[model samples]
Target: MKRQVIRSTTLVETLAGVDRQSRFQHRRAFTLMETLAALAILGMVVSSLSASLHLYWKYRSVSRSQITIAQLQRGIIEDLTSDLRMTLQDPVAVRAASMVAAARSESATEKAGSEQFLNVTEQVLELPTDLRNQPVHFIGTSQAMALLHEQRNPRFDQARSSYQSAGLSHIVWWVNSEGSIRLPLFHSGPQLITVAVNASKDRRGLVRKARKDSGGSASSTSDEDEWLVAADVTSLRLRYFDGENWRTEWNSFQQQALPLAVEVCVTIEGGPEQETPVVIWLPQASD
Candidate 1:
């Protein structure tokens, strides 16, 4: 009986040892596999996060560029509208009156000379009539624009005071060869304002002469102030709306009065050829 009891205890110890060894081996295998799987999942998560961050930065840059362009467009439109409101017609009217007076003074030439003097007088009279009959406050083409209007001091600072004291200024907007928008304000100087007009066309789309040339001298030599309105201006188009229809060109010298509405289309770099332009109404100048 003592031998059987010792044998039974040894057998039980052996079986218990085998069971523990098998469980330990199984646990080790499971832990190694779990570690490798966890690492792979972590790598994938990190890769996805990196990709998301890259996309976010790219879109942010594009958004900033778009916003900047929009702000510039709005500024240009506002500046033009504000200046157009306070248009000065008295000067043009006075000039027309003077021309008529000059023509009348030459009336004696019709009897004193041949048809040449008579023809000159007739031509002078016709110009004064056209000026008196038609009020050309604004005139422009696709490339350039001239505004013969009085712009009030839009600022509330010391600059505004100076502008007010200096009186109204003639404003011109034109595009340069380098795709830059330039505005040259002729401070009550009509003669200088003519240099800003790109009314005629040569071999190119429009004749772009020196910005300012006083007798073949470079304009930069003078103290004339020119403001850089905006940059990267690919194109600028204007449309005038009569009560009936919209026209691409506005020749105030030909048209009787200002259009009922005006549309300004500006094309900037990295944008479409023609964007939705700003349209403004001018009921005051319509008549």
Candidate 2:
């Protein structure tokens, strides 16, 4: 009886030991192909996760930048349109015959009142080569001479005299090499105010900043130039609507007061063109 019991215990112990050895061999020995496949799967998962994170960050940055640019554009456009709608046509000329002397200095040439006068919101000045009855577009204000000269004749010599005799307003725009929009308002001959500042040639910016940062004590060359109706700008392009057609240029002068409507295109850098032009449909006033 004791020998039979001892033999059974030994047999059970031998079976348990064989089972442990088999499990250890199975875990320790794997084919090269099987190990490579496992590693490949792990690598694929890590790569996918990294790619997903990169794309998410990129999209987030673009979206944020787009929103900021849009907000600035909207604010500027709305203000311009509101002022234009209130603009009248061919009102009484404030003073048609106040002659301003032609400026000798290019800076002094583009003074207000020297070559242009405002009738309500309309400025009455002469053209260089006799426009006869051609339409006029006043794109900018002469801060240097704001309401001072109120006259212009594009041919007025800056070197000869401080007076151009006569001229309405002029429109000129150019995009610079460093991505700057340089728009100068020249009345007699010199540039008065510049829009979309030179970012670098910030003489204008400095003057403006002093006015803002110094609690309003900064002296400016053209202080009386007030901002009148302006084209709503988008992506550096401005479209003008003349009631009949959406125009990129102002061709004729029917003296219909302000433009019938103005179309502004907005395009941001590194993004798609804005599909909708900010159509500033002017509320026509009585002729």
Best by lDDT: 1
Cα lDDT of model 1 by residue, 166-272, tens digit: 33334456655533333332312222222333322212221122222233222332212244455566677787887899887665544535566778787778765
Report the lDDT of model 1 for residue 180: 38
**For model 2, the run of ten residues with the poorest summed lDDT:** 205-214
Instruction: Provide the TM-score for each candidate, comma-separated.
Output: 0.60, 0.45
The regions of model 2 sitting more than 4 angstroms off are 1-23, 30-40, 92-200, 203-235, 251-256, 273-275
Pick out the ten consecutive residues of candidate 1 with the lowest summed lDDT: 201-210
Q: State each model's C-alpha RMSD to the native.
A: 9.9, 15.2
What are the clash counts of all predictions, listed in order?
A: 0, 35
